[model samples]
Target: MEVYSKKQQIISAINALRHKNQTLGLVPTMGALHRGHLQLVKKALENNNMVVVSIFVNPTQFDNKEDLEKYPRTLEKDVALLKTVNKTNILVYAPTVDDMYDGLTVSQKFDFDGLEFEMEGKFRNGHFDGVGTIVKRFFEIIKPNNAYFGEKDFQQLAIIKKLVEKHNIPVNIVGCKIHREVNGLAMSSRNTRLKPEHKAEAPFIYKTLKTAKQHFGIKSANKVTEWVEKRFAKNDLLQLEYFIIADAKTLKPIKRKSNKKTYRAFIAVYADDIRLIDNIALN
Candidate 1:
């Protein structure tokens, strides 16, 4: 893997690959790599001639200062994992905040309208705008033929697709399946902060989501969310953040459904100070 921190170097390297007729793929990340991230890289490898993964934890995305401070950074280990997978044709772009933002102030913000005001967006506040800005910048810099994102951040994925369409970006956006641990907990960098006991109970989030999916035909969104909330509330250690059943695309609360429609149940919880999120789809 070739590592480049400067913009010109990265662009030059990408140009070289383009000269060779290599189809470029990009996996934009916030650094703390996990199985979920690697899954995206694997998908990119299969579909594109070269893959570039950007690992900048954009400060603009974090609403809470402490949350940003606590967010994990395991660069050495992350590089080791990438190397083990023989992602040799990969470029790891780790840039500073100044390098990313520079003199270009965040004057204009991209909003996914209702999509940004629902579920995670409602809780985080302005999170998607930060996400949209960074992703837009990455797309401009990388200029990949294709870009990959995991479905774990389903709402983010949806908003990014909208951004690409609204702005007329030329890259093909691909969504990969959410990668999870053997016990069903969605793999996340935040999971590292959980206490041992909390980690064991964490799988229940996914379990509940799966259960909700099974009962989507019988239960209303309100009932499903209430039940899940009650279950999480039972554990004093777990502070429920948000539990929602909404349209997978718009991320808006779903009403009565019809055939062939897809709904997703998303949950965010605080196991002590560590916040974790997971979602499951009902088709």
Candidate 2:
């Protein structure tokens, strides 16, 4: 696999591929590659003629400086892992922060049609705006035929879909399934920072979600939320931030039965210093 740090070289290379009528696919990721990320690469390779994996830890997306500082960076290892993929045609774009945003400034704010004011949006403050800025910039630079994103960040995926729609970006956005550990903990870069003991208890997040999903239709939304809160409270290691059953599409909290609309349970919790988020369909 060839690795390019310069934007012009990668763009020029991709242009050459376009000349040959080779379909291009993009997998955007912050490094410290895990099985969850590799799954995206695998999907891209299967359908597209050539795949470009961009490893950029976008600074604009992080509202908390400490969170940004602590975010994992395993570039060398990440590249080595990408090489292990079965596909022969793969390029890795590992750009520096300046490489992405040297002279460019994102002044225009995006309206995700109130989709941004829900769970993650309510907490992270400018998080999705930062996400939109970097992603839009990448789309401009790469201009791939299709882009792959994991469903792990479901809300972010929804906002990105809106970003493409409002801007009329000419690429298909594909949301792959969420990958989890054998123990049910959602795979995440932050998992590396979990203390050994906390790591053991981390699976409880998924366990609680499964329990909530089971009780979803049987019990009221408030009761299910209360049960999850109490479950986390029982263990001091896991701190519940917010847990709500909401319309899967709008992400607005649901207090009563909706016969037509699909609902999902969205959750955020702090396992020690590492914050993890997960959601499950209730329909």
Candidate 3:
């Protein structure tokens, strides 16, 4: 696996690949990669002629300084894992923050108004703007033919789709399936922060979401929210951040008579300061 830290060098490498009639695919990620991230790389490799995985722990995306500081960094192990998957043609762009944002000040922010104030957005203020900024930077740098994101971050995936279309960026945004563990907990880099006990209980988020969907149905968004909230509240170790039944596309809180075509039950909880997020569809 070849690692490129400089923008010019990475661009030159990509251009050379293009010159050879290779189609480029990008999987942007923070350094602490897991099965979820690898799934994206696998999909990229399958569909595109060349795949580039970026492992930059973006500081801009974190709303809390402590969260940013504590975000995991296991680049050595991550690269080794990548090598096991494939080595010869894989490219890793692991660049510094300075390289990513040389002259770019995060002046303009993406509001995404309704979508910005629900589950993850309401709990972690300004989080998506930071996400938007970093992703915009990534798109500008890589300029891949296709960019892959996991469906676990449902709202983030929606916002990025809007960002790409609104800005008229030429890349196709591909959303991959949510990869889960044996116990059904959605795979996430933040899962590493959980203690063993917390990890065991972590699957409760998915289970709660599933229960809400099965019992209440989309016609009872409020009831679904209340049920999920109570489940989190019952767990003394869990501090409920937000439990929302929202329109998947807009991220707006669903109303009783609202269209139920695509609804998602989203939840965020703090298990002693380790915030975990999960969502389930209500369709």
By the lDDT metric, which is better: model 2 or model 3?
Answer: 2
Q: What is the C-alpha local distance difference test score of candidate 1?
A: 0.85
Give the residue spans of candidate 1 off by over 4 A: 103-107
**Relative to the unseen true structure, what is the C-alpha lDDT of residue 274 in candidate 3, on a scale of 0 to 100?**
91
On residues 1-283, what C-alpha lDDT tens digit does candidate 2 reach at each position? 7889989989998998998999999999999999999999999998899999999988877888899999999999998899889536888899887788886744347899999999998888788888998899889999989999988899999999999999999999999999999999999989999999999999999999998999986998999999998888888899888997889888889967879989988999998778999988889
lDDT of 3 by residue, 1-283 (tens): 8899988889989988888888899999997999889889999999998899999988777779898899998888999999988997689999888888885645258756466666787667778888888888888988899999999888899888988888889999999999999998999899999988888888888888888888654437777677777777789777888887777777887775354368778888887879887888888
Model 2 misplacement above 4 A: 103-108
| lDDT values, one for every candidate | 0.85, 0.90, 0.84
Looking at model 2, residue 157 earns an lDDT score of 91
TM-score winner among the candidates? Answer: 2
User: 1-283, model 1: which lDDT tens digit per residue?
Assistant: 7888878889999999888999999999987898889889989989998899898888878889899998998887888888876667788888777778896635257756677788887788679888999999889988999999988898888888989989999999999999999999999999888899999888888888888887776988778778888888787777888888887767778887867667888888888888888888788
TM-score result, candidate 3: 0.95
Task: Specify the poorest-scoring 10-residue window by lDDT in model 2.
Answer: 101-110
The alpha-carbon lDDT assigned to residue 124 of candidate 3 equals: 74
